[model samples]
Target: MTSRRPLPPPLELPKPGFGRRTPPALFQPIMGLFGLGLGWRAAAGAFGVTPAIGDLILGATSILFLYTFAAYLAKPLRRPATFMEDLRVLPGRAGLSAASLCLMLFAVVLAPYASGLATGLTLLAFAVHVGLVVAITLAILRGPEEGRVVTPVFHLSYVGFIIGGLAANALGYPEIARWLLWSMLLPAGLIWGASARQLLTRVPPAPLRPLLAIHLAPASLFTMVAAGAGLQAPAYAFSALAAAILIALVVSARWLVTAGFSPLWGAFTFPLAAFASALVTLSQGQGAMSGIGGIALVAATLVVPWVAYRVFKLWPGGKLAAKTNAAEA
Candidate 1:
């Protein structure tokens, strides 16, 4: 709501039977698990933490993705627009895009088993994601004035290509990944600047503050991508930036969570895991950065799964669809 209107008050807990169907936002937890798994895997490589721990998380993430994907897929049978319903809203667009991005991540997960399948899924996810970006752009141009508002979630809409690039790299297509990831720098920087200006001037309500955690994801993701690409200068530069953002978030943690455990807290998972993964990569098992990475890894280990649990708890009940639209409307 920081875009053009006043922020709403904190969310009151929904009573029983809030809603029956889950929105694409369900992908948030899945995104969290993917981040955590990748972070753990990075930690194992850098810090000699047991690889099995990362493997276990990845294993569980695959199963969870299947279960949740099936559940969400079934929604179209009940209401066809459910496929694109969430995309029509502000926050939900991020979830839908995350769902698309997770498809790419899941594709990476499948690479060890079926390289061909993984490659196709990566392409398909990117195609869907591009379509989403185009659709959103056309929608914004085609009609409703309110849809013009840009929330922090827009990061997933345009800047999300960074994930596609990461998946492409993981899938053994570095050239493709390079083009996709590096090309995103412009959009990412622009979005970050615009979002920061909006937040600084307006300061969102408590319920929405959790979304600020999102800003952390871009820097960390960029750092990991840069480090993995062997671009040390930019990697360290982004690492420094990520550390600053992490410190700010930590210092303001109390204020950020003033709404205290609403569904919105799902916002915390990715940035935490992303930074852990970034630090682990940047540290490469040495120096003060490594120590910081260890701390971040521990925090991600503790928090990401808890977030998955909390998000799923909200899945079965709550007027999520209703409240989501009204949150910034």
Candidate 2:
């Protein structure tokens, strides 16, 4: 008997719209670049570095955010279902949460120039973020049993309330920020414990190893919050913890990127920026970890742009959009 050729694979057609094509994962790099700017500003405040350096980075970052946000905002207008659908995935859940955090940070950025607008964005961010967390929780429980497994990005969803606290603190609402930060610690601790158990049991796939970097972000952010609260003892403890985490991650760097570049590289951005900024904050110009912080600041400054370029390139070619397959006529 003659052997017949196997049927061909389906031809894929991508979803429409450049905005719809852009994945939420891209937001992580935006947040990272913004964090880098803030890191420099922290250095300037603590030491004698130029505030202009940070201001320049921040101004550029704002422009980038407007462009990215405008593009992403178009997704919902083009296809609301597609927008909602994205929230079901790991990158979508984490990236959009990062975006909400981005909005909160933007509120602080806009505060000096337009207090009213700043307040409005902060409220909008809070509502959007909390709603996202609820929706994600429900989605995981309802279906897509695949998403139920805990992973490093869970840190972004659960521990990121620190950014809201940071924004509140910046807007002269320290009491509210204090409440938010203190409350955040419980969830952050829970996620860390759960994630550690999962990670220890199975090494994440190569593409996902980069997300392991997210483990460092919460501690770094809490250090800043504790320092702001004048809880020096706690701040020092958190700072030490962040340092150890960073060292461990650095040692594992070879394996983390063994899968090569992916949108997940965005996971590497904010934690380093936060840790660097935290080090600068704790230094208080005393020349403690400021040198190491500067090194991290430089690393982040270089890394964010590279990741942004890689992710944005995906949008231009429609590589980011979902594709549909149909039988050939």
Worst 10 residues of 1 by lDDT: 320-329
Cα RMSD of all models vs. native, in order, equals 8.6, 4.6
- Model 2, range 186-286, lDDT digits (tens) per residue? 88888888878987797788877888998899999898887776678888899999999999999999999998887788889889898988888877767
Instruction: In angstroms, give how far residue 217 of model 2 lies from its true place.
Output: 1.0
Q: Which tens-of-lDDT digit does each residue in 1-329 have in candidate 1? A: 46787889989755333223656666877898998998888888887888899889999998888787776666666566655555666557767777887888888777767889988998898898899888777756665886686676878778887887677667677777667667988888888888878877987878889888888888888888777666789889998998898899999999999888866676788889999988888889899889988888898889988988876776554455545652211
Clashing pairs in 1: none
List the candidate 2 regions with Cα displacement exceeding 4 Å: 1-18, 322-329
What TM-score would you give candidate 2 relative to the actual structure? 0.89
Range of the 10 consecutive residues with the lowest summed lDDT in candidate 2: 320-329
In candidate 2, the residue pairs with backbone N, CA or C atoms under 3 Å apart (3 or more residues apart, or in different chains) clash, namely: none
